[model samples]
Target: MSVDMYLGPSKTQGSTTTTVCDNYGNGLNSLQDAVGNFTADQVLRSLAYDSAKGYFKEAYVPLIQGAILVVEATAKAVAKLPSDYVSEVDSCDLKSSELEREIQRYETQIQGMQNQINQVKQLLPVSSERAQHLREANGLISDYTSAKAKLEKQLQKLLAFHAFSTMIFTEVTSLKSAVNQGLAQVSGGKGFNANKGTFSNANLNDRSWMDTIGKKWQDREKERLKDQMPNMDGLEYKQIDFNGGKVWCWVKKGRTTADPEDIEKSFLFNDWVARMLEKYGPDYFKTDREKGVTDLLVEQNLRLFEEVRTGIDSKTGKKLTPAERLARGASLVNSLAALGVGAKQITNVGKGKAGQTPKKPPIVGSGRKVPAIGKPKKTISAPGKKIQSVKGKPSKVKAPVKGTGKIYNANGNPDLRALRRPQFDEVLKNGFPDGTKLNQHAYNSLFKSGRKDIMIDDIIDALNSKPISAKPGSVEYINPKTNTSVFVNPTTKEIVGIWPASFKK
Candidate 1:
């Protein structure tokens, strides 16, 4: 409505009793131009509130903040910064009231200083007008000094701001370069040149022996071995820490021999063991000893299983006919032997593996009365208090008296039937592998020699004293400690002599 709308009379110039309504409305556009406006920079500079100095003395703060925002926007185009702190920085502002308050504070300081100077001047005698002018001049100089100090403070702030911006630019530039270089290194067809590893590189995820040492080192080791062993064109070397020492493993690439046939055989190095070396590569077994032992057991069993399946004697190099092969594939061999066909009886039908002697199955027993397998175990009484103790030593067990430990039943008769091969049972009783002796068997027998420890008369007396009824075939005592097998005939009461265990059964 116009100015006439609210105070305009409903009737033209009509005189009426007092009827009043307040009209205080101002048009919406009346103050549009009068509204205050502020720029981003001015608002930033109005932060200080000095009683006398009023407002930001320098404009560098707003400039510094503006530069920071520009750099941040630039950085966002390249990569993520540590943090985008610019938005928080932009939120800070200065207004007139704060600046006015700061000016008032400084003004109060000036007033206080002036009063002090006036009190000193009053304490002195009265002076001429010219002298008074000189005193007033001193006051002006003091004011100028304070103002100069304040101006220098503002300049110092500008310098600090410049330094801050410089630092930010430097940091952002470094970040961008690092990110770009990293991306180009892997994605630019040049894969990272990280070490496959050294033994001491601790960053490895899998801490197995292989991973501890880098892949490059292993490959170099392989090449080195190949160069050293001309015969093993594909020689490989693996390292293992065993028995608190480092052991280097050597293996052939294929089933070929590295040395001439006439050379002394190194049983520890061979193709059969190489498979184990490969499986445990980089990933180490507990120690060198474990590796060697496991390799021995594996190769021995592998050969045994292979021979049984194919009916080919690995040692003799002889092949079996269809009938003999069928006999093995069938359970006929075990059944026949179970019925007392001699297990040691060489069945020519199964003659196999050429270029070697035809070997028989392990002689489980050597008597008509002995069954195929599984002989009873024996136990002996501990040394009793009745036996006098040896001087200077605790009561101890002497070597076993032969025939003393025979197992007996409630009937009081010793177990004299179903005999086991004593010599082998002693050496490999824990597990008598099916066919061949282990490679370590020779190593085991290195300390023992063959000889008759007990003569026939002594053996006979020893057995008769115990009242152990003898079996018809040879009676043997296998001593794993001595690594020897002593043989005798319990029924015949004769000594057959002692033999050292061999690598091959």
Candidate 2:
């Protein structure tokens, strides 16, 4: 008789269910039943002596011996039965019982042999390496399992959080939509209108009311948005002085019509005048006053005229004014005089005067002695008729001295030559010395007089006591003859002027 232990209340608490005490016993019985079904001869036939037989034999011998002992013990136990058990027993039954013992023994031997075959297979070549690989594979499997578990846990958590967040977002979106709809309804389907009112509203009735309160806010917002947007206001054509001084014209706000006269009037209007005063201050008006106003008006008109003229010409492809013809007569005479072309020569040319005709000299008294009119000539005879033809080489002709062409050589001023080399290297390094004042007209006069040999720098220095006031590159040397100015590049020392330097004499 085998004893079985029952744990208290095997059914889980609070769960109404029956627990099976024989479940583990049934599993063991099933294993035994399968083993018992095999025939002893069949189990023995399955095992053959091979390389695997050594391990099988080792195990099988002891197992067979133990099974034999068990069988004998069982037989002895059965033999103790009363005479009634013998009456029920048959001879075939005894044989079958014995055969079952043999089957069990054979099956034990076969199982041992199978274990030995597995062992032998493990002992094959590189078995240790294979074992190690299997172990590593097991370790990787463990790692993957752990990682999968962690990932699954994280995924679960994320799914939960997503559900929660989605719920919250849905709620918030619904709330916002509802609130917005409510606001729209309250504000007459236009949303919350902060500054909405009728044109005739009491607040808007006074123009100064908005000017007083909303101006600053509107200005700030405008500035903020202006910063955000690119200013694509087109090419703002501002009327500027030729020298880029004060602005002559500007597009007036709310003025769509571009009439030249109207534009001028806009510039001269009170608002513009007030703005100008504010920008330039009272002194600008006081000092300039009439001249400033006149200049502003003139420039405005000129700029408007130029704009209109350019637009018209572009459209028509024609000039509005005729070619300005040069007047002859006194104007020509005056121009020649201005050019320093002698007035008398021009007068003569104007009158068509011709040079006087050449006259023949008077003949002396015919074959008679006549007194010489002026000093008597002393006649010298040709050097005593040498009569000798010298047959030597001819004398060499001496070369004539070249003319120095009107250059003034200072009498005893050797220091003047030193001036050619730079003096006060730092002070006059850029140009002439400081405090130099140029005779404004000299540059044109010198060039006109054909004094080409005079260096421009020297002429500038000569005219000024100190340095030239002009920046190095700013010195515009104008040749009156050509009516063109030479623009000297300071860095490259490049002189760019009109073509044909001769024309610029």
Each model's TM-score, in the order given? 0.16, 0.14
In candidate 1, position 331 carries an lDDT of 24
- Residue-level lDDT tens digits of model 2 in 307-327: 232432333555432110001
Q: On a 0 to 1 TM-score scale, where does candidate 1 land against the true structure?
A: 0.16
Once model 1 is optimally superposed onto the true structure by TM-score, how far is the C-alpha of residue 39 displaced, in angstroms? Answer: 65
Can you write out model 1's per-residue Cα lDDT over 167-229, one digit (the tens) per residue?
434433543343343333224323222352111212222323222223333453474453231
Model 1 stretches astray by more than 4 angstroms: 1-183, 186-262, 265-483, 486-505
Local accuracy by lDDT, each model: 0.29, 0.28
Candidate No. with top TM-score: 1
TM-score for candidate 2, residues paired by index = 0.14
